[model samples]
Target: MDPQTEGHTGLGDWTPEALGAGRVLPVVSAPEAVLSRDGAEVDPIADETVRLAADLVATMRVSPGCVGLAAPQVGVGARVFAVDVTGHAKAVTVHGTFVLCNARVVEASRWKVGREGCMSVPDLTGDVKRASRLVVEGALPGSGQVVRLTTDGFEARALQHEIDHCAGLLFLDRVAGAHAIYQRKVYL
Candidate 1:
């Protein structure tokens, strides 16, 4: 792990070098078996897990408008993911870039329907209901330190979205009905 990222107190310092300079891995599309099965819980400090975390962040950065990504999206069935909602229009509490492992929602409230799309399901978007306020518990990629993250609005939604990916769920699985789904009009 890069000391600059590991020693930094802020979440924004994350860079590809932090995890041994992770490379951008190809994202697998929907219907792929890896995206349908729950990801395996991973050791936060494992070499492979750290590398995957780095790669996830690297991949998310390259994808336009993508605020989060999961291991399964890259065909790795591990409960690891990356998120960075820094400058999103709807973001309320940005954490910059960070990776979490085996994350679980500990608290959720203020539900509302929001439009969501995924790299794995590039052709569609859906109005899925998610909590606007949330608390998640998970371990950090390199430190193996468990953390309780409190966030709301878009950041919360993004976390839930990526968490769902780790659990083998697509936004398509959360929509109220077919009518709630729409063809993605914008590529970005």
Candidate 2:
């Protein structure tokens, strides 16, 4: 697949083999050094990196209630993440499914506190203060062209959360205090 055109519409065209979509990579849990260590930027157009990007999207789709997944969470020390906010109750600005490599928040504003959880840090949930609006920029996995995403509300929060992972930070790192953290609750 051409990396340049893969995710121009947010969600890429790759799918699981059965569905003819993409590959689903394993999710790494907390306490793993990779989850806490900073990620290095890689050539987005590399075949390995492109495959990793597809794996991120696939893993995020299969995980219940997951809106995003970062590369480090999959044991890759590269700056990449996949996010899809469709049908999420908390989502306001939906971006469908998209992968961002070497992502960074260029602008953020309108702070708000929201409860958050992570696939890596599954044992805990926390109330995190984050910007409600954000302008994020990153390279497209296959094409290496820089793309900017303007989003607000839940999508903004999800973007920030995943970007934090790329920076070797977790929502736990952003929680206000001990009182802000709680045991994760299962929805069903």
Candidate 3:
């Protein structure tokens, strides 16, 4: 269950486990909905957003300690994402699958870098600066529950990082130069 196994292709075909654990993650959105250089909407959320979010949760368990996932890791470019802050599945209030549509970062703090790893860019990790707290807004799956969340600590950082992936940004982009980069020390 070493997610950072060198040369390993992520969770691969691992079986889905728990509410947010599995493999074969969904790659939602085309290249059309991403934001352009001027911050214009290019790739918007679609049917794939929901599908990807479900699969991501399924794949998280196989991900070896994953608590969150983003569409881009699956190769999608939509502003969609999902997360389960509670580390243990039974203790997870949001244990079930979640899908986000047209998500946005409403607020953030100039916090220090947090250790990060990526499913797409596996076998590596680094110190990446992210907001200490985040105010995120998005539409929920099926219920269409518009969620406005204020999250902090690992939960907040993980969510914001994944959302950035949905927006075509990578944790590497926020590494704050070489001084902050590092290799993965451990993987479950």
Candidate 4:
């Protein structure tokens, strides 16, 4: 898929080089050391980082039931993630597809309880309380333009989830209690 068509026009110029390097990265799962480690800020303009962002998007597209993915989940300790909630049943705000570098949640409000899961921790899911609305600030890959995204509903949840990965936290860490956690149901 052309990364250019995925919402952010700033990324169009770098998409080719990003995808030119052949190799679809494998998603790192739980018990992997990288998933638990905090990610470092990525150089948004660097070709390598832009390529990684493209790989993240490619990886997320191939993974079933995945609406988002973090660099840590792919064994890269860089503060980057890709999210796309388009067409999701629970999505109230669709962002199409976008990648962020050095992302942070600047504001979050309207807390709500929701079931959360992760690509890294695939075996489990949990009920975690997260903000229903959020304002995220980050640099767009390739362009290095800082962008702020305000969203709510499922899109907000997805953002929070990916941001947590950058901070070395997981849904399991936010689970309300033992009762709040459960074995994941097969998406298929």
Model 1, position 99: C-alpha lDDT score: 91
**Where does candidate 1 stray beyond 4 Å?**
1-17
Q: After superposing candidate 2 on the true structure, give the runs of residues whose Cα lies further than 4 Å from its correct spot.
A: 1-21
- Candidate 4 stretches with Cα past 4 Å from truth are 1-22
Q: Which 10-residue window of candidate 3 scores lowest in summed lDDT? A: 35-44
Top lDDT model: 1
Ranking by TM-score: 1, 2, 4, 3
State candidate 3's TM-score: 0.68
Q: What is candidate 1's lDDT per residue for 143-172, written digit by digit as tens?
A: 776667789999999999999999999999
- List the candidate 3 regions with Cα displacement exceeding 4 Å: 1-23, 26-48, 88-97, 186-188
Q: Which lDDT values do the candidates have, in the order given? A: 0.88, 0.84, 0.57, 0.83
For candidate 2, give the lDDT of residue 160: 94
Query: How well is each residue in 72-177 modelled by candidate 4, as lDDT tens digits?
Result: 9989988999898988899988767888889888889999999988878878989999999998878878777676788999999999999999988888888878
Q: What TM-score would candidate 4 get against the native? A: 0.88
Q: Could you tell me which 10 consecutive residues in candidate 4 have the lowest summed lDDT?
A: 1-10
- Clashing pairs for model 1 are none
Error of 3 at 124 (Å): 1.8
